[model samples]
Target: MCCTNNCINTENPSGNCVKGYGYGKLIDGENIKYINCLEGKCFDQYILVYAENSFKAPQNSLNYSLYYFEIKCKFEREKSSVWMNIGLRNLNTNKYIYYYANNAKIYNEKDEAFNVSINWKNNDYFGCGLVYPPSNMTNKSPYVFFTQNGKEIGEEILLKDNSESYKPFVWLKSLSVEANFGNNLEAKPFKYDISDHLILK
Candidate 1:
């Protein structure tokens, strides 16, 4: 049977969408670092960083991790509207620690800069070389609203803060192709809508 669902929109809006994944290798020269995907599940679904690029380094002979990214989300022409929950438990302590990105940069321009942001619903610590926001872990995740030529296009969940409940609603607003590259970026300048069905894991 030929079924046309929410996966068939040329303006690439809702239905007629494709479910695929994208990946990229982030290299800084010879000191490779691996950035894995949390929601995506593909062989190339992880970010691999190896080597070092002195040209893009902060200083000569200094170890700087500034790499461009090429991400292939599972659902193309779609935005996130779910608060998918994830966790990492400490075997020694038997404590489950939840994790989420305040914002994420999915792609970069020809200049090779990051265009992503994150909003924290909560912040907690787990002790793994990872830093947490300064607050309690709330059950709110941010979203992304895509647009072009001043026309609304599509949207997706850019970050997953929790799996319980969200308030007001969060969104990843407008991001310049030439934004700064660093951690702790916040989602800004975008609109937010509620989608009680989507979930990220």
Candidate 2:
């Protein structure tokens, strides 16, 4: 037992630790968020958010009923091999369908990352996340797609389950991204709605 600020004593039960955001349980003071990402490369897992309401777009050209969320490239990866994924996951299964910048997947499944012709870098605002699309819009499949800037840059990906709700899921490798759920994105217009240009009112 020592009596100094630099020394650990009975009076100090909490040490120096930084609690981060994620799905992983709290340990010591660090957070283990990545469910299936490369360690030392992927990081920063936070709570997913979505807009759940029936509303109209800022303009009268679009009107829809559904829930969704989006993400933007806040930072680039340190390595060339590292990329980012913006996905939606089944709350129950925890499995997700995600997007990549320069890659694709043969099948749409959990933890699968697909490319969308997006060179996600600084100032690149990507809106590649959606929770639940109408059964018809989804083609009876649960899968979705990704978007770049203000327009979608990829094709329709498939999913196994469209029944369960989804949450925002991100996979970052040597990169960083920011998630937005229509809270304060006037500067970053949705660019394009994931619902295939919702029926105009």
Instruction: Show where candidate 2 strays beyond 4 Å.
Output: 1-64, 76-82, 102-107, 110-115, 129-143, 158-162, 184-188, 193-196
Local accuracy of candidate 2 as per-residue lDDT tens digits, 1-201: 111342222243233213321222222321112232345534433323222332221222122344455655544334454455566655556665666554543225544444444455565766554333343443433345566767766676654533355655555543444555665457755666655634432
lDDT by residue (117-181, candidate 1, tens digit) is 44322211111111121123233323323322223222332333331221111111110011112
In model 1, where do residues sit more than 4 Å from their true spots? Answer: 1-21, 25-44, 48-77, 81-99, 102-201
Q: Could you estimate the TM-score for every candidate?
A: 0.16, 0.53
Task: Work out candidate 2's RMSD over C-alphas.
Answer: 10.1
Task: Give residue 16's error in model 1 in angstroms.
Answer: 26
Distance (Å) between predicted and true CA of 107, model 2?
Answer: 6.1
